[model samples]
Target: MATIKDVAQRAQVSTASVSRVLSGDARTSAEMRERVLTAARELRFRPNAVARSLRSTGTRTIGLVVSDLLNPFFTELTRAVEDAARAAGYAVIVGNADESPEQQDHYVRILLGRQVDGLIVVPTVETSPLLHEAAASDHNIVLVDRRAVGVDAPIALADGATAIDELVDHLVATGRRRPAILAGPDLAGSSRERLAAFRAAVARCGLDLPESRVIHGDFRAGSGHDALAALLTGDDAPDAVFVANGPMALGALQHLAEAGGRAPRVPEDLALAVFDDMPWFSLLRPTLTAIQQPTAALGERALSMLLARIRGEDVPDERLECRLVLRESTEPRSAR
Candidate 1:
């Protein structure tokens, strides 16, 4: 119920001064800002965001529509974005798309409807019409961790080439001759990049990556489970596998833990590694060998790009490097 005028009176400052201080205007003196803030806090004064946004174009808030929150990669990325945005005096509204194009489009509509100053989208695929429309309309957007085809926006993503190559080298040196990959949906940008890097890595080590070894998953546990089940058969079954993401790695491990069925003991019968390192990975009996994406960098970089675009600055896509972390899961076949 407290008004700006009430706080202004308490601080003995004009309403205009209070407005400037509350809006984070740099022109406000430190002493005046402190006085106004103290009075406002004492009075429990809350700014009318709707009225303020009506007067100014920027809401001082942006939206982040991510591919899926179930994946810890996105969860960590979200926290990073929140931290950077908060430090820059902005707030974030996060939308979880759950890897559904329709859901992503719906969230886009809702986020734009809220008049968000800008948006950072982890696109579901390259064919999202709304993404194109938003770019064409000049709505501020920055793609993170993935790209939407033909969306003329700056992007911040990961380049897993070097890490994948390193992973392959490690596997080969450890005697994992026959290695395979459990990839995500083929159309997804990250999936395509990772698959390419993985194949190129295999080839570099004089190994063959048959199309049959490239099993596709939906970046979820169930799909990962099914993909592993499909690959674990016949004389040609792979001796090693690299799961593309954390959830899929979990599912693949689950398949190996089936209660009554014969399961291949890891590093004994099979070797395992994964992309997208998670905190809990180390807790597993045999810690997982995983690739760690520059998750925090991705969030901070994407948000900075989005903020720059909002400020009428031109930005370009940049890719961060990934790291291969060694753990017990991919130990040498001889040691096992």
Candidate 2:
């Protein structure tokens, strides 16, 4: 393998000079630096990142922990984060927690063991203590999507309340009085915020959201399908259903298709609205109406925030607004 000594000998410079040039230490003359770099490149030399990290005390690696990789929303978000991290000359290590607190804790320990320079996490409920401990130990940790209970790290989240309010308002304007909700697990911070906003919107519109109308599901397509099926088959089926995220919305659509005679027609027998718009949604039958959170932008921002924190900069928590996109599935009742 090509080593610094080989490159230095080839470039007629000392090993120390070659090291300075490779590290970009700014002490080597420009002409000598160029010659060393050319010699290294010609020899196909690669720096040992592990050795360099040991010397600099920085791995230039960021660890990302997500609740579920199966969800399309999270998949896209991860892509954005990885792309941005790579562009910034950092490596990313990803872990999926499957929405389990124990799994999340396990991943945290593993990442710390790897000596990752920083962390970005989509926290599960009851994981605050672990996060707190990391923070206390001076680890650079940033919360993404959900904030843990006791940790004060910078957070990047969607404006859940505003998104819910907009969805409810759209449903009301389109003549959906009895709107049901498929909420995510109550322990999740995003789910709680969305549900709270939904309830407040229902009350503000003078509509009684009965306990029977609210169904809880994990933020997955299957859970969404099952929850909507339960709600639709119940004694009082909703005139409209608002799903909290894209996968759930897709699941609800799938269930609607499989229910046969009981299937509620979009914008006719029933209206549908969802949070978190995806690329394929607009092309679906009866096109999905949704509140579009900036998924890629959210991921990019979270990574940027974490990087800033890793660099010892103070970054405040941030929330991005979601835009309501009206589509065929939620046409005005009068138009139908």
Candidate 3:
């Protein structure tokens, strides 16, 4: 087992210098930091993070709870958070809540019990008393990708309103008068925000979005398929559909393909757009249009904000915007 003493000896520096370098103290000279880091790397010296955390009252670890691990958006965000944490000399523990409030709360308690230095959560619901209590008790916490009310923590949100506006405009320009939504569960902040935004945008465009046009799902592929099926079987089916999140969008696409002659063919019979762009979207048969949120940036900024809070710094909530990515699935019927 390599130790700090071995690293200090190899670097020809004092143990204090090595400690300062490892702690990211800006006072350490660049040359000394380089020497210490090189020696540590060469010796494969792993710091006793747990012991240092016990003494300093910090775990040097972050806990992240996301709504759905299977979702590509959340998956990418998780990777980004890990990358950012690693760069800052910290480790991240992830919990997938599977869109269950109970599961999310369980992870929250577990992470808190583990004494993580900070927490970043993509909240499964707007009401989590445990999270609120943790915040009130001065836990270092931040909400990412979703917002939870009554939690005294900074939040990092994406511009859902703008994305919905773009989606509506595209649908209307593509000559789709009737539009529907395959929305996520109502308890989730992201779902509620997107739903409200869609309603407002459609109304602003002088389109009547009846209650029947909106269908709720569990943010899963199966739920998405079911929602799409309901829409297709309806007497007055929509000419365009907006799916919230990527996994659901994929499900809706699959449903459309499998329906054969029973359902409308995309573009020619129906148009579709989705939130959360994926790498494979372009490669799909008809290619899909989507709103692309800065997933990686969201994760990085959320971690940075949580770290700042853990360091006793005050920071404001952050809001990032999504971009509209046009593709064949949303092209005008005439153009396709």
lDDT (10s digit) by residue, model 2, range 16-122: 45655677755456787789899999999998877765735677899999999988878988999999999999999999999899899889877876668788999
Candidate 3 off by > 4 Å:
1-55
Q: Give the TM-score of candidate 2.
A: 0.82
- Candidate 3, residues 1-336, lDDT tens digits: the string is 998778878986545456657878675667878999999999999999876556355668989999889888899999999999999999999999988889998898778766688889998889898787667556789999778899989998888688779889888988999999999998888898999999999999999988788999988899999999998888879999999988899889889778888878788889988988999999987999999999999999998998899788998999999999999998888886
lDDT of 1 by residue, 1-336 (tens): 999778978986555456667778674667878999999999999999877657365678899999999889999899999999999999999999999999998888777766688899999987798788667556789999877898989999988899999999999998888889999998899999899999999998899988778899999999999999999875569989999999999999898888325878778778899999999999997889999999999999999999899888989889899999989898986685
Give the clashing pairs for model 2: none
Per-residue lDDT value at 34 in model 2: 89
TM-score of model 3 vs. true structure: 0.83
State the RMSD for candidate 3. Answer: 11.3
RMSD of each: 11.0, 11.3, 11.3
Best candidate (score: lDDT):
1
Evaluation by lDDT, superior candidate among 1 and 2: 1
Q: Give each model's whole-structure lDDT.
A: 0.88, 0.84, 0.86
